[model samples]
Target: MNWKKAMTATVAISTCALLMSSTIWAHGYIEQPASRAYKGSNALGLNTNVGSAQYEPQSIEALKGYPSAGPTDGHIASGGVAGFGPLDDQTSTRWHKTDIKTGALKVQWKLTAQHATASWKYYITKQGWNPNEPLKRSTLQEIAVINDKGAKPAANVSHTINIPSDRSGYHVILGVWDISDTANAFYQVIDVNITGQGTGGTTPTTPTDPGQPSANAWSPSMIYVGGDTVSYDGKTYRAKWWTSGEMPGHSDVWELLAGLQ
Candidate 1:
């Protein structure tokens, strides 16, 4: 082939490879509860023209791993990008919040690109957390974990989690979509205002007689082995594995028992 023809063919091949890579490795971000980037862009009723940049610019390098205890505080909302710096600024009026009560809540994600997933984990800021400061791993608590076992999600994946009854006021919820086959993961941060009673009415009153195996109240310091049951915030959970220091509503160690009386 002539030089010009060979160059043209090469460029065409490169372009095709780029397009295919983009399609197969498309990552995702939280759509429900309105993540900081989604909330800032037109996707969530904002006036910004973030367009195609919505998913692209907001994604971070996943090699750093999730729940890092370093300086990721500022990158909490944008998944570690300084360009989305405004998302890190909690005081910005442009950041909108979703109103939620401390009970069963549904969270969803929109995948611009899909990959085989390892798991989806959710974390929330502790009550009385400092909203004005950048988010730190220590300030948050893991609430729910869904293991997909490398299965690919649909364009949208929704998860329902029972929120801790004790949390109130404005809190940040972080969703991590860890990819099974790749080194990268997607991060999304959602701001929420927890309303209604905080941890007051969750547990129902049991009979005065103490002989019955009335629901056991969960405590972090308590160790739980499989089949051991406990109650927290009105719901009952059975341990899925042996664990201690893992809270009931938030950790995968305990599975909620939906219908046991």
Candidate 2:
């Protein structure tokens, strides 16, 4: 072939190769309620950028043997992958959380590339589980499991799961999407506040000024020092020490104040 024709042919082949590579790397992640990796309303007004490419970067293979098997205690939130350690950081202490009322909750996932899904399992932190520590299998209790079994999930797959009616306060919901054909599974961790309300529950109260503590639910990302106060789940708290990531109701860093009722 002539030199010009040969160059054109080479360019076409390269383009095809790039497209094929992108296709092979397609994977899924939780979108609604905003998984740690997803970007949208849940991420608004946060001081830190939760949309880190390293958290679940494209082309990164999923971790295998989840829940009981893969992803040791320290990396549980990040699916036992490198470069995602920040998601599990206990010191950074601030992750955006979605405020939800207790009851049937609909969770959704966005698949950049769809694969035959084996199943989707969701686990939430047990009531009273310490949020100041890294996530572990022991810290979570399985809440729902849906078996897809080789079914091709839509671009936006959704599942409705019941949240415990009695539980309240900040929690993490970990989602695992097991691939039917591959030995990998996609993992997503979502922060949520469970207010004691059934369906059509009361909306979360807007946050008040940073200087004045309002009835607004506490967020992990907010920094608190000695004497700083906040309200969570209808209870008020006074910080005893400098802390973050410690849920107001669950951590020792904050002391619940009496006579607030």
Candidate 3:
């Protein structure tokens, strides 16, 4: 092959390699106070089935506009990506909550790859939002927002977020690391114990009844007969008929029984 032809072939291969690596090596996640991805990661010696998220915690990269455009309501935790689906599973008991007090708290990010930053926004769940419910824009209120004006961030990016004093129990803090160089942004959810106590910052009893809201998770392969009930994303649903494989909320086979608890 001629020199120019060989150079073109080499460039094509390098471009393909770069694109593939970008998709896999995602960028960053909260490190201190343990974001969900870090809490259940294999590298941390933490053992929890978070799918690929356990292996690649920094990869929760998603679209940029968070409250308005990005990864819709029910899929915030996983950055609306299918590979990190386990992060979307909602349950107060499912994730490890970090003990935190309201006021000035330092949150740190573990960046595997740094990019030109647009902004770093922090939002906390609304005062009464259910811990078991999937995170939504309506359920969260912004606590802090910082823009770098498209400057590349340092290797270690830490922010001092002043949590609202009125919060209590288990609350999720959604952090969006906006990348100025790209259309995507990285997301991380920090399950914080506002009162710095137990799982909820207060002792709470586990519900015994399977019928209780969020007591049982919906499994796609599990067959359900008419009148059968189950929970998904903190909502209770009743099977309108013998249904299997179809998911609740997304299908007509399941009827909405009740809202989040």
Candidate 4:
């Protein structure tokens, strides 16, 4: 009877350890826009020196409640995991950027192991934040949040969130997926370059190409991009890149046109 009891106790301890190990390893990453983790994977190979994340793209699990109780500043991109520490490196060119626009965006996640969810929140680095330094909460502003109410998300899930029209230029988006059943959440950072005239609510005028004619004489106040043409003093001139207030033939930025009759 004593020998049988000892065997049972050992088996119970081993099984409990196995379960804990599996639960702690639950992970996932953003698919759409291609998160830093997803980009670092062996499958895509968008980045190098990714460390363990290259083999396990979804392994960035961290404590729940981001910005308040989550990973430390400067390490948010890596979920504060030592093995994935390379992701915490910051630079304007450190990570590739996804071209994004203002308004509604569809963000998708590839969950290798789904769990009961509490909420999935998204935040973006505020405009004028330094790109050469590690990301911090003070530089981020909440963009969207989805409350899942402890329901198990699908193996693949997408959320439609509206990006504000005030953000422009380079920005970093931080996504946090809170697991209702665990003490952890998955952290993913997405680098993006925003275009379009934000807050202006007006369509950005397309730059005139080589073959397009200028509507009128170049105004000193008018901004001109490459390939923009203007007719001034009975001659046609082509302007290059922000050629404002410069006479068509006086500066190298404007070239005299010969083919137009």
In the range 151-238, model 1's lDDT, one tens digit per residue, is 6666667666667887877888888878889877777778788886533311121212323334578887764434467888877777
Model 4, span 174-248: residue lDDT tens: 889999998999999998888854332221123345465654777776654444678877777875433357787
* Colliding residue pairs in candidate 1: 26-113, 143-250
Residue-level error in angstroms, candidate 4, position 231: 58
Clashes of each: 2, 2, 0, 1
Pairs in clash, predicted candidate 3: none
- Per-residue error for 208 in candidate 2, Å, reads 46
lDDT of each: 0.66, 0.68, 0.77, 0.79
Cα-based lDDT at residue 148, candidate 3: 58
Candidates 1 and 2: which is better by lDDT? 2
Q: Give TM-scores for every candidate, taking all chains together and pairing residue i with residue i.
A: 0.64, 0.63, 0.67, 0.67
Regions of candidate 1 where Cα sits further than 4 Å from its true position: 1-24, 47-61, 69-71, 92-94, 198-261
Q: Model 2 over residues 34-150: C-alpha lDDT tens digits?
A: 766563223343424433433343323456667667688977766656555566664324776788877778787778788887777888889888888888888888877666547
List ranges where model 3 is wrong by over 4 Å: 1-20, 23-25, 45-47, 196-261
Worst 10 residues of 3 by lDDT: 199-208
At residue 133, give the lDDT of candidate 3.
Answer: 81
